[model samples]
Target: MSDKIGAAEDPLPLRWLDHVATAMNVTGSSLILALMVLIGLDVAGRNLLGAPLPGVPEMVSLSIVAIVFLQSPQTLRAGRMPRSTALLDMLTKRSPRLAAAIEDVWDMIGIGVLATVAWATWPRLVRDWERGTFIGAIGDFTAPTWPVKATIVAGSVVLVLQFLARIWRRHRIPDGKAQ
Candidate 1:
């Protein structure tokens, strides 16, 4: 028990990444709560006061993307990302090593996909930040677009790291136990 606890307590980079991903997940949950509150208020105002909340539409649109990005890293880390696991499950019963290898390759592909997304997003993030780009009308409820862009980029990078960590962990364990 002590050994297991100590092993878990070790300050490894992958553990640090897990901590970061969990923190981001919590932030995403908080954002979701905030959005719910905002939406509820908007509905109440619209029904009772005959006036809806300003910028609610824009905020929802932007926040939807940010929330997905914010929560994705932890989702992947937790093995909760949606996928067809039927083949892997069948293969794992026959050959754990082969299944582990396939899983690692999948993680590699995930890293590549996320890296490409981050690469594409970086220039846009910079452009938005530099130009002070916003999503709302002038002299009204306006929010900077760069924050959402930055969140996307950051989330992609962290997800890539999580993928790498998964591969690393797979290799560290014996083949039969990898599943």
Candidate 2:
């Protein structure tokens, strides 16, 4: 009796969730591309002109975490996260519903884990924001740490939302097939 869970005709909330996920995913992707450009520029400046840009290390480290977290929600929602799916895939053929149920359980577990992480990081974010703590040297142009922490929280929250949305989706393994 089950039907497609997140059909195009779904209510507003699911659509809103999709919109936010897509936006965050796009931002994450853009950040990755920008990082590539920045690294290239830094290398060029360093090797060609012998003028290495300062604070790149700090930027790269912080951006990497933000990028992963940003894309995590969409990746998980689309069932694209790397994992051993052979067993569940085989089960899908035999019992799609059961496979889906098991998948749902995993999704719920992910939600719990990510949500806990976000909750735990909350205080750190507050401290960074209040203290205005930063990375890089005093004369090397320091970057604020709060943005990175906030991004991590944002990403975690987005991932949690995606996990819950996966439960609402009520699909099978999807295996690159579910929309």
Candidate 3:
């Protein structure tokens, strides 16, 4: 709903994908809030009770990566992805078609990069799942790494899909749908 581009302009499938991305973004934001609370509690515990949360540091490390991946697609779809727009801005004034073409190319490159990241993460995810890989001490708090790896792969795929959607949106035919 925070998207700069209106949802009405998106095709049904793209709209569905946007919904998915928005849910993921919400989940990421919730995770951030949880982390903040956990850190605050840990600090309070340390200062007041002289007992800190055991897995706070490890949880924070894992959550940071999860947060970034979880929220990326929505960030891009909202037109909040950080980039210099000097060239595109100038190009748009001169030729809108050329600007769209250049944006499509840029999106294509984004697809490649995210796809590559997902492809590379797939094996690690499998390995972690199969081996039950975990972080933290043996007798203390421990968390499976597979979930985080899975998040990375899933997020990357969604991000690639978002990039493809961007390209498709740019190249839609006169019928108001992608070819």
Candidate 4:
């Protein structure tokens, strides 16, 4: 039997996770594009028609939060998150084993802190939803604030999980060689 399986033979859980991540990425990209287009139109309308788009700021803020949360896991998966590599590079050159150990420790601490913050913020998000807090803006454009808040909590949790995965994968490789 071959080690590789056909598409039909793939596990549902893995497929589902892939689908979810793909959907999140696409949705986040669409939201970002829409936000950009909307802002452009808003600015044009303001300059041309002398009237700004009502609640543009509120919409932009919410869209930005959604984009960040939805895109975070995808970014983490792609290893695109910003990092200061000067220290890590120096340490790795000196001692790869020590650098790996330090990285694992750092990831563990990050996971713990992010998980704790997510846990703490979840209830507050729920409470905000229950209270039906609205964005303060002129006119009747009321945006629900809980969803944005919850996104922050969810994104942090996902980032923590991603870091954990990275740490586990790093530990699995002998000699810390690039795969």
Tell me, by lDDT, which candidate is best.
3
Per-residue C-alpha lDDT of model 2 across residues 3-85, encoded as one tens digit per residue? 22355754688878777878889999999999898899999999999997888888999999988888887787666889998
lDDT of each: 0.85, 0.83, 0.87, 0.72
Q: What lDDT is reached at residue 4 by model 1?
A: 11
lDDT of 3 by residue, 1-179 (tens): 12244357677899899999999999999999999999999999999999998899999999999999999999998889999999988988898788888888888899999999999999999999999999999887899999889889989999998888777665666455543
lDDT of 4 by residue, 1-179 (tens): 11111133335643444455557778889988888998999999999999887888999878787788788766765566677868877988898878888778877887898788788889879989999987865475778889888877877767676676666556543455553
Query: What TM-scores do the predictions have?
Result: 0.91, 0.89, 0.92, 0.78
Candidate 4: Cα lDDT at 64: 89
* Clashes per candidate, residues 3 or more apart or on different chains: 0, 0, 0, 0
Clashing pairs in 2: none
Q: Please give the range of 10 consecutive residues that has the lowest summed lDDT in model 2.
A: 1-10
Ranked candidates, highest TM-score first: 3, 1, 2, 4
Clashing pairs in 3: none
* Most TM-score-accurate candidate: 3
Which residue ranges in model 1 land beyond 4 Å of their true spot? 1-11, 174-179
The better candidate by lDDT, 3 or 4, is: 3
lDDT of 1 by residue, 46-127 (tens): 9999999889999999999999999999888777889998998898889888988888789889999999999999999999
By the lDDT metric, which is better: model 1 or model 3? 3
Off by over 4 Å in 4: 1-22, 173-179
